[model samples]
Target chain A: MLLIEMFVFLGTIAFAISGSLLAIQKRLDIFGVLLLGLTTALAGGVIRDLMIGNIPPTNLAEPQYFLVSLLASLSTIIFFERIKKFNHSIAFFDAIGLGVFTAVGANAVLSFEYSQPFLIITMGLVTGIGGGVLRDVFVQEIPQVFRKEVYGMASIAGSVALIISYDFVSPIISLYICLTVTFTIRMLALKWKW
Target chain B: MLLIEMFVFLGTIAFAISGSLLAIQKRLDIFGVLLLGLTTALAGGVIRDLMIGNIPPTNLAEPQYFLVSLLASLSTIIFFERIKKFNHSIAFFDAIGLGVFTAVGANAVLSFEYSQPFLIITMGLVTGIGGGVLRDVFVQEIPQVFRKEVYGMASIAGSVALIISYDFVSPIISLYICLTVTFTIRMLALKWKW
Candidate 1:
């Protein structure tokens, strides 16, 4: 459980940095930079929580999540030139973030006992991609997930894998399966430009 | 109250038809057309309900809303050529939708006792524009509300009106004031091309 939480936090920071980097690239103001970063880091979980009737979503209610993302975004904005040199590492961490979000989302729905197979998978996919979609839409660009190589597909696959393994394995094991599957696929997509 | 519900229904139809029209213009499939129409008609309320902990939003739980949007979308798709002739009528109804949604959104926040001044106004603005933003994002367009003249501003003004009048007037009357303010501003913006 602790291990999973650790990765999720790392994912949050990675997403925040990525969001801020994109905002800077777009030449948004300081406020815009911060807003975009927070949105990308938190929007997915917030949307998922809302759909499941989790009011005052954890992302918003927990100051720790907000603080972590804020620091991540600020650092990225301040040191963008240096961070730009670590493009490969950023992408690698982003892939991990994608994997963790997908698995965690699926688990959330399952834990809620919604009893709908589709809801589990749908929530999983949305939780993985929602932030990026909002980020792109804010910038008035087509969502890269819709147009980019294998992104949504990778998330979908990971969610599907989780659903399939969930009945057979421990919940934690299922999460690992999902995270591994998603990260592997996303990384492969990036490696060969799939 | 019945009168307000009637106008809200009218607004729902208008938003649905407008969403479908844009979908058809973009040459999307029948499924895309239907999805966009439903999205424009209901997403705002869903988002609002989620924020206030209204589980299984009325927009989704109540069949009437879905039926209205579905019928509106279907009719728009079938008689698009004829509908094109009523451009003026559609805009008029859409303006009504914008007004009612803004007022209702503010009233909802107030009724729920959210207690934050900004929450009331923010919910109102988001409800008025959320559907349109989702619709535009689905089609990869910059949200019309963000770029268009005075669309979001009108909603903001109406919400402010509601908050100001709530202390002195009946809730229904506050809604009326909000509706009138939003509608008048939207209409003026359209007329003067602001």
Candidate 2:
């Protein structure tokens, strides 16, 4: 398996766990929680693929991705109390998921050979925030991206950093740069009054 | 305005009203109801557009859609009792909204030059059911589309009919044929044992 593919798989698992935890917090039924997790894990990438005219959708094409999401959901369910007690851990993990997914989304768009400036930025934002948007909407809340958290700005920063470093940096370096930019922006947003 | 544009506008209004009515039924707060109504009215098309890479999002580009949604939401809040007494009427209106939006969405994609195939069919289904999916997810109900109802199938049939007729008939004729197919399928699904 390619390195990038593995990263995407990790991102999917983290995203799914984030969603599962959110649903569990809401006291949703087990089935509902799983559905939420699966949807959050796959929905952003699926929508991105469909929009860019990628056929078959990534989730349907990859069983491993689905398995990861399922396992994450199950784990959350099995460890609800333990997970609940580690709230900061969950938040940091979710942030990492968001950062990695943002970078991966930007990479996917660039790989597709789409160079439109706004389109690339938008892809990064959508990919990073789409799952959370769906999660909030499912829970009947305003999407987190729309609020003034600088959350989506992390996605923008990551995408821009990836694009700028494309010429000089190695792929691994680019990934870290993107992740660092996103993680720092997100953490700072949470730390400082934004 | 172009005839199709007018229909799209009308469809938005109709969907907005239906969303507002559902919110009222749920006894949500006024802000919550309006939020539900506006999001439901706009979400499907927004998702469709984003998937197709239509940027800036139509809802964002046109303020009137928001205005119409607001008016519809406010009207429902003011006239809840009257609307409640006419549940059947509201359902019929909602059906019309569905029919109109399905046709509009199919036509828009066809105009974008996507050829007939599974993609076009999927687009129609997305457009038809997107808002309702958002609505159900918010209400925490199992989505009507996934259930045994013929909801998405109706839109798929309508889209296919539209595509088939576009080669031989004027746009208006195609619209009529599409609407007829969609409305018939939906109403039958509601009225009959199937």
| lDDT, candidates in the order shown | 0.86, 0.77
Best candidate (score: TM-score): 1
Segments in model 1 whose C-alpha atoms lie over 4 Å from true places: A1-45, A48-54, A58-130, A137-194
| DockQ class, candidate 2 | incorrect
What is the Å distance of residue A88 in model 2 from its true position?
Answer: 30
For model 1, residues B1-194, the per-residue Cα lDDT tens digits are: 59999988888998999899999999999999999999999999988888777777889999898999999999999999999899888888889999999988888877776656566766787788889888887887756764565787799899889889988999999899999999999999888987
Writing each residue's lDDT as its tens digit, candidate 2 over A93-177 gives 7677778888877777877989776777788778788888887777766787898568888889888988889789886778678
Residue pairs of candidate 2 with colliding backbone atoms: A51-B51
DockQ of 1: 0.16
TM-score computed on alpha carbons, candidate 1? 0.61
- Residue A71 in candidate 2 has what lDDT? 96
- Fraction of real interface contacts that model 2 preserves: 0.06
lDDT of 2 by residue, B86-182 (tens): 8777667667767777887777666677654444655666677788788877767655554534666678789889879988999788977887898
